[model samples]
Target: MSPVLPPALRGLPVAPVISHPVGQQTTVQPTTACELPQQSATGWLKEDSIASGVLIVLVLTGVQRLIGFVRSLLFCRWLEPDQLGQWDVAWGFLMLAAPLTVLSLPGTFGRYLEHYRAAGQLRVFLCRTAVVCLGLALVASGILLVMPEAFSWLIFGSGAQQQLIGPLAGTLLAVIAYNYLISLLTSLRTMRLVAVLETVNSAGFALAGGLLIYCWQRSAASAIVAYGSASLLCVVAATGWMQAIWQQAPQICPAIPQREFWAKLLPFAGWIMLVNLLTNLFMIADRYLVAQFAPGDSEARLALVGQYHSARVLPLLLASLASMLAAMILPHLSRDWEAGSRQQVSRRMNLGLKLLGLSLTAASAVLLLVAPLLFGLAFAGKYQQGLDILPWTLLSGVWFGAAALAQMYLWCAERAAKACLATALGLAVSVVLNLLLLPRMGLQGVVLAAA
Candidate 1:
């Protein structure tokens, strides 16, 4: 017999009890629309809806790149080629070690942040990620500490440059912490702040380096010191921002199973770290090889590295669009993917590729025409030939940018292993081509292989 309903309940239709497969009663839940919480987007691109945050990142990154261009142009004018060469190694060493510092956790961290937040494990997620990354950082730092001078000689050349060992050791440790914190901020969608931090670092380095060079009578040590100072500032600012956000974030759950947490995050982290590391190796391989193959003493080979680095800069700048878009869209893509918004993902990915192609092609033409003339005017003598190499090197950047986009998609799709495999295959191809071509083609061959 049916139970008697209260007067208030009599007007409503009763929900029918349904039998479950396990022989238990079950009830269906009525549907309601999901409301998304408001979040900050990239400053200038906020109006662009789904793509805004990334567009803003690209714009700010472009501004920062321009500042970097100014710094490079000024330094090249102020210093001799060999001096520039030595400084390049010093400056680039920090960037080259980025894979170690970051371990590609930014990508993986963002992925899991969305998952854990949905599962009501936000606090636990942050803690586990932080602890794991911190441990990895400590281990990497210890490796660097064990024979700093050997690193100095290997990277900067000669035992006399041992002065770099001390500062570089500290920079490595500081940057590792910075990378982890910044990754957390990114996962939280604090993109505007990230852009600001990047800008501060870029603009700060330019101004600081200029002062150091002018005030100290122009020395490589001044440039290195300036870079380290800027990096430290970036780290401090990122820390402050990360702390502010973490403190305010809603904790959905107080605890997560440690064994299960690590089990999920580690596999993805390990694979991505390899992907980022190998990609880094592929990017910088040309420099070392160019140095090795270029005739002359250590100084002369180093100068060639400088030339290659400079020639490659502007052309590669064109690819920043792709990177900005990739970073900006990653969190969104990860969420949409989890929510089963397959159609949305497909549309955006297709549009991004079209935009990349149209913009890059036009920019490539402009670069091809303008680069030689501009380099000739700014840097007299051999630099005019930099454009000859510029076109090929530019191709590499554009290609790399495209691959980066595909990789981001793969990452968000939870295909970390597949992503690593793809990158490894490309790295292998690059390595083989570089070996075969550099012997006969010289610098041209190196970049062609890269392209």
Candidate 2:
């Protein structure tokens, strides 16, 4: 008699009522457990991948240094002061040709191909890029042919002798191709392969150049030829290695080459190309300036060039290490940025800066301490002038390390415009300084120009 209910309602099952601790009735509501997204595992995996890449790059750096040191010893023992200076000039010309020729698109191709390969579209991208690189190489070579005198005049002036031209052009062609392959391997994150190629190429050059100097009693021109031959061999070897991988299964596609492949990277490529050009100017302008101003002063310039080259050895080695590290981290940063992973980006960036600083600092200290003795031991005794510029040139090394970090950030941020503008501005400044300084200061001026 407690409560009365309708007949139809009484047939329906009653909902369960639960009593709370507060003495209130409550209805039970079944709740499913909430699942939050987990990124820690993926983040850790990404970090491990980056660390692995860094380690590989460091190992490669060590390999490069060992090879380079050996080559330096050979150069010191075999070549005369004047010949080494001429050799430096020849390399300068080759560097100039590099940027104007496809604006270093081969490198861009490598970078882009790496990305596409990571995305599982390597064949399509690689095919397209290959065409572009080949075509561009041809076009660049053609342009050089027409304007041969232009660069020669700028670098060597009217005195650029006929004998050097062939060697120079040949060296440039091989260097351009070799650069592309090395860059491509780096992009693929195959540091060991890159290191192997570099080691092989360095050994080839060292042996060939040494032979030319020792056996043939050759001039600087012969050294140029040796370098060219070595570069060609390295390019061939790298290509063969790459092709071997394709032998398992091969497919054919449209002949769209680098032109099509580069389309995706036009924005960054443009700036990067310009930046590279400027960089070349900074590195090579000193040699060119010395050649231009000190045309009749070959003896003095030769000694100076030999020394500057020696002092630069350690810096270049460290720069390679920095560059390799930067290359590997770029992809990781790009990925993190795309995924809206701010924390990861910050962490990666910090790590990059630390690594760069540490490497550069250690390298600079060693270079500063041992450079004079090393220079004395490695080259003709005349190369002592390079010691004069070591401290300042070390600055360039640190700058490059920092710049590499900045560049990676720009790449990740997609700030190509800013990057290009900054690089262009820096290049312009360096060029202006080179013209102003080198004529007055000689090799010291060249060092200043480099800085």
User: What number of clashing residue pairs does each candidate have, in the order they appear?
Assistant: 0, 4
Off by over 4 Å in 1: 1-52, 90-92, 101-107, 114-146, 156-160, 217-220, 238-243, 249-258, 292-294, 325-359, 380-385, 401-418
Give the per-residue lDDT digits (tens) of candidate 2, residues 1-451. 0000101101000111111122243333211221221122222112234467667657756776777777767775576666676777777777666646655555454335534433345566655556766777777666656676675555555444545765676677777777766665655556556656777877888888878778886577778888889989988866665664343222433334566655666644554555555555555665666666653564665656666676677677667667666766776886788688978998989887887788788879977887767766665555566667878778787877778775777666756557656765766676677778776776677676656
CA shift at 238, candidate 2, in angstroms?
Answer: 4.7
Question: How high is each candidate's TM-score?
Answer: 0.73, 0.71
lDDT of 2 at 18: 10
The residue pairs in collision within model 2 are 76-378, 128-257, 128-258, 132-258
lDDT of each: 0.63, 0.61
Off by over 4 Å in 2: 1-57, 103-105, 111-151, 158-160, 180-192, 238-272, 294-303, 325-363
Q: Write the per-residue lDDT of candidate 1 for residues 352-449, one digit (tens) a residue.
A: 77777677777887888877667776655545445678888777767766766666676566565575566567777877887788778767887787
TM-score of 1: 0.73
Which candidate gets the maximum TM-score versus the true structure?
1
